[model samples]
Target: MKVYNYARIIYYRSPLLVQILAIAFSLIIIFGTLLHFIEPDTFPTLFDGVWWALVSVSTVGYGDYVPTSVVGRIVAMLLILLGTGFITAYFASISGIAATNQQLFLKGETAYKGNEQIIIVGWNERTKGTIDELLTKTPPVKIVLIDASLKENPYASKGVHFIKGDATRDDVIQKANIQAASMVLITADQSKDEVAADMQTVLTILAVKGLKENVYCIAEILTSHQLANAKRAGADQIVETNLLSSFVMINNVLSHGTSPSLLNLLKEVKDSKVCLQEAPTALIGATFLDVTHEMLQNESSLILGIKRGASTYVNPPTSFKIEEHDLLIAIIH
Candidate 1:
């Protein structure tokens, strides 16, 4: 019983393709063994019997080794009736399962089972561009897009999984495997009014936090007043699209091609990013100039400034001291 249990565990643990192939091979071996014993004169060796069985099971009548006796013919008839049909069904099942799984995935019925994936809510042009940029990453990031409007996964070809449900709902977020996600982005739903969209974004953030509180979340707040609401609902960052666009537009108007230059600069800095990290132990109590010089000389990273608690100071005075619990803001290349 223990051996049988162990065999069952091994069989179930194998991939579907390997399990199917094992069964097919087992059937072929049994049929070949039967054929060899039934007609020793016709099939002189076990390999010859296996060859005949293989050809018969594939329905490819080569006519190389014909069974002469009545018992041998019965064995051939059984192989044709069972083995051939099973082999035909085997190929059909493989194709059918693959097609069915694809359809299910596109329909957003399948749950994402991977870890450290990025989940973006709302299906808009901005989200689409974000997904394209994230996909350009070297190791390939898995992104799950959740929206209630889309009938099926529009970016299925690009390997983006879709969940066709309201992002504010716990069940829908669970389908995305939210607990294992690295970050969640709640884009404002354009279908709703500005205020309602921000409300929905905040709700989605709450739903995501309910499942995993520590997961970082970014929400888009169309209305300025809703920014605080989004943060209160567990949003780590809030993107003010209108304010940011207006800032860029005004700069572009004041100086022609300013937006283009800024965009190019952003693109150039893709390989190097501004990041905040806990201050190293050695940098404790060090002056700004001392830390900056040491960081540039040894680490090649620019020391932007020190972040003490909730306040961030960029390029503090040369005499300013770094505390023990301060975070260092730097541009890492």
Candidate 2:
């Protein structure tokens, strides 16, 4: 029973190509041996029978060795019928398997072995647009997308890995190698109710924070009331996308063209876009105006505000001094 189990394991583990080649070789040897015995008088050597079998199976009859006996001819005909078909089918199967494996690999079904990667959890209408923005605007970075709803990776792109699993699970978070990830984004599950979706996001944030405390987490909240819960769950930043959208739409209705300019500021074009970057160590004591002037001269950046602690001060007075852990909100071209 143990030996039978071991044989089954080996059979299952062996690649299709190896199995096909083994079967084809065994059939060739069996037919060749049979032909040798069928016409030993005409076929002087067993090697001659093998040579005829090989050529006949491959459909490349050189006519160097011909079977004379009726039984030998029948064997040859059998080889041509079975062997040729088997070989053709084997090659076709191999090609198909290779193509499928390649597709799976591209779809991120395979395990990822990347470090300092960005992991985006959940997929929704906004997911693809966010991914596109990151790919176009940010520096070259590997992104691993995690979602249980997706059948396969939607992007199938370079520098992107997909893991099909619930982000709220610790095992799934670990599979994405969240500990080594630079950042994690938990998008709202739009399919669920406002409260339910936010709770799901909070759960995922907790799972990720439990695994890696220092990793930056940005979660999308559907309702304003869930912001506190998300923050308590270890989300470094919470975005109320629905509220922001409402604000933008209302502002556009009140004053047209204002929203477009605001939207354009976020778009990546002419290498100019708004970004929130950490303040350099050298700019710790510099005033806002001084840093702004220096950035224009050195980095070609326009200092818009400082994100210090949990507060954002846009277009602060020039008297405001750069803090120790301030994030510079600026536009660069």
Candidate 3:
């Protein structure tokens, strides 16, 4: 008598199809052995008995080999009935696994592995402008957006990624690759207060900075009062949206239709009409007056501000000397 332990093998691997296959195989093998024992000389060898078992269970009934005894025939009937359910279940499990894998591949969720992208926290009306401006100004920059309210991402940019969650949480920030991010832009949610929004932004900034101290953080604030608090929270820069709006409104009132022209001039990109350029190290020792002529002549640019190391010398006159590592924001034509 050959002993085959099907239950033990099925227990360790335990899948629906595997369990069915084990049960069916066990039934066929046990019945074939029993047939051999019942009619000792009737059944040839173990191999022939297994072949007969397979044929009987599958309902092929080759007729070349047969179990003539009543007991053997009874076992054969049981094997045939059991094999039907096993075979059906086996194929069903296979179809299920295939369908699941296909769905996973279609969603593109399995291949999310990359680094050094900008992460934008929160989504609002400003998000549209932020995305548009970033896309226009910076080429080939990858952005990961984190927001809880967004049900579906409306924009379909190639390199943009979206994570649905609260950005204030550490795990959520990590999902957006906050540690490896080149910059983190925190925009206030439209429905929240300026202080509350700023608090959230500050917390995100602090969390990111805790993970990666070198990470650059920029936050948008609705009020000027939150600017100092945001700065204290390790934000590299704070953009006061109200201040910008007021400046634009004032410009429109003062210059009438000329405000549009001024805006166009400030934001011009192609043909180097008006450009902002960082100061080269070689020009650091020179005075503003020395670079003024060169800037106006061939460069066709005007020096608007001198960034000396960490300090900004805005609208510095011709007498202001340029310091080492100073960035000169200029207007070129």
Candidate 4:
């Protein structure tokens, strides 16, 4: 009974298609050998017997090989009767597996096992827009989206893989293949209150960094008090949604028409994004004005600021001297 249960465990663990093919092949081998030996003249070779068994069971009888002896005729009849059903079952299993896989994929129960994929944790208008933009890029970016509230993949694009789960859990993060990801973007959970959402975001960052310390993470923090906690949780960048929204509203009220232009300006430069580049060795002691002029002339890049350690100086004095370890904040086209 123990041995039977062990065998059953392995049998169930094995793929359905594999078991079906194994049974089919076993049938072909047994009959092929029997036919070859039972009637040597008609089926001279084992290869000939296997070919006939395969063809006959598949319902493509070529009539090249036939059995005349009564015993051989009986064997042929038995092979056809028993083998055909399993052979037909093989094809049926293939279609069934494909349909099941498609269903699992649509239900967001499938795991993504690829590398360099960008994992986005949230489902909202923002995530939808971001995914749409990523899909439109040349040499398209691979994306895996994780959201507990979603029941199915929201996008029909093959570029996105969706996993429905809590991002703060290890099992879900592993399903997203976070260890092999290039970076992760975590948005505040809209289902929770502001404080709880920020806590969730920070907890997610901790879970991700614990698995892959070097994987870059950008987490959204809804409350100001959680800013230090998010930083401590190993987020490479923090998107202060509340601060940004407040600033946008303030700008719209004060400057009237500038907010639209500001947003348009960002859209216009979508192809190029702001990045931190190692400061040119030659610009170590150069003035900000000189370095800016040189970059604009040589690289067609506009210098945005100097980032030193945790501080950023945007549009600093033209005479500010560039330091050895300063990172040049610029939009490289």
Candidate 5:
């Protein structure tokens, strides 16, 4: 039984084309020797017999050589039938394998070759919007998606590449080329509970950060309680999606139409959208009031406030000094 299992493994592991060619070559050689012995007087050389056997089996029957003996003709007939059958089956098998490989490549089983691309781990409604928004940038960015739930790429554009695998796995992160990625965004799994989803996001964050410490990682968390855990897991940014959703709901309850206004403010219009742009180099030593007026006059932007480190101060005092590395929170549209 062990020997039988071993033989089966070897047989399945070998390529079908190689196996078919080996079998066909053996059959041709065997018949060629038999033909030479049976009709030694008709064929002076064994090479002639082998040549005849190949041509007959291939149905090419060039008629350059033929077996006059009845026994030799019978062998020729059997060789033609068996050879043609195997040849047809071999071609069919090759076509099937080529088709299967193409489908696998399209479904993201193949490794991504793009570099300096965005890596999006997991899938949700927010991810779709993010992808659409990214494609509209001044210079569009390539995005690599890693998700186990998707069977194939949902987007039809070439800007996005998909890999079907667990986001929390190191192999999957490596397949997405995390080391060369410009940014990594991990979305919370909607199918799992809040805690489970946040845990999965944290695990992915840790895996990404472990591989590339400098790669910017933004992770989505379902609950605000998991914010610290995500940050500890090495995420550079943690978006509390559930908390933001609750705030929107609360705002709608307190003031009707407030949610729509907030949504519009956050939505992207054409190529313009609200962003936290870095403070201009010339404005490093200027006061808030000076920079705000310059931005409004020159760039036609509304200066909301400033984001320094992890803290965001909205509508800070006009006298607040604008420092280097400060992010200007403003409305671009």
Candidate 6:
């Protein structure tokens, strides 16, 4: 049979355990002094001192050893008062440490880096849908999600990584690798004010832009009023859910019947149908008309818009010329 290691157990238990032991030892010293004065013959021997100290400190008060003298009894009262308080505090500290360590291990500590990856800031109600869509539509794309409330892995996606921290802080942004990220998406927190959400989004955009001026950033704002504010902060794209909802509602009213084709066109990959494809750079120097005509001839995709440097030209006329570094957003067959 193997004996358990007490030293190892004590080392890992808690820092306060040592202090508790000290308090108990001090009380034993006081009581031993009293016993010596009252009756030197009955005073605890070395082994008795150790045994009695352990039993009494553990609250296992045995009646075998009794204090008869008035001074000895007074010393016992002092031990009762101080020892109980120290033991309670030590247990509380141990509990707190255990809880903190459990939380960190569950959430993980790996930071994000590299390029062609998506960074999501601020988790909210729409986050689940957004994550599901990104995973289903864009396979093998790495994603790093940053939020303060996240204490564990929220989803089981292979490419999703969670970072437990405040998204507004620059350190958190750097941890998420904002500089090398292909796209940064700021989800609006419904619990916060439209202005406050926009402010947070703008601050994140500024941080990413300051680090890497070419990183693409998309911010979701609650209202149209915040659109200009987000744009001014260096966001390449601003999405207003309210505006999109209104457009859908208006279209449904105008045509006595809702067009499934129109709805399908509006539906993003989140709906599990349309997938956004990044057109190859080989199409550079090609005319918009030629590209559209070829797409129609090949029955491959519908060219929707062209992104130049930091600007996006939506529904550009046929004569528009495509330049290098232009990202063409289209629906894949």
lDDT tens per residue, model 4, 133-212: 99888888999999999988887446589898888899999999988999999998888999999999999999999999
TM-score of candidate 2 against the unseen true structure: 0.72
Off by over 4 Å in 1: 1-54, 60-64, 154-158, 252-257, 279-298, 303-306, 314-324
Report the lDDT tens digits of candidate 6 across residue range 42-122: 555644544554456568888666667777666667666776667667777778878875565458455765667788877
In the range 1-333, model 2's lDDT, one tens digit per residue, is: 999899778877898877776677767888888888898876678787787788888888898878887888988888888888778878888899889877876555676778988899988878887787778755677889998888877777556789888899888888898878999989999789989999999899999999999999999999888898899999988888999999899998999878888878555444677889988899899999999998889998888899988799999999899988899998888
User: Would you give me the overall lDDT of model 3?
Assistant: 0.73
Ranking by TM-score: 4, 1, 2, 5, 3, 6
Tens digits of per-residue lDDT for model 5, 12-101: 788988788667777788888888898988767888778878887777889977788789889888888887677667778889989987
Task: lDDT for model 2, please.
Answer: 0.85
TM-score of each: 0.76, 0.72, 0.63, 0.89, 0.69, 0.54
Best by TM-score: 4
Clashing pairs in 3: 273-332, 273-333, 274-332, 275-332
Off by over 4 Å in 3: 1-112, 133-139, 270-278, 295-302, 331-333
Residue 9's lDDT within candidate 2 is 87
> Each candidate's lDDT (Cα)?
0.89, 0.85, 0.73, 0.90, 0.86, 0.71
Give residue 68's lDDT in candidate 2 (0 to 100): 84
lDDT of 1 by residue, 183-238 (tens): 99989898889998988888888899999999999888999999888888988988
What does the lDDT read for residue 296 in candidate 3? 72
Ranking by lDDT: 4, 1, 5, 2, 3, 6
Write candidate 3's Cα lDDT for 190-264 as tens digits.
778777877777787788787778888888888777778788888988888888889888888987886787678
User: Counting only residues 3 or more apart in sequence or on different chains, how many pairs clash (N, Cα, C under 3 Å) in candidate 6?
Assistant: 0
> Candidate 6 overall Cα lDDT vs. reference?
0.71
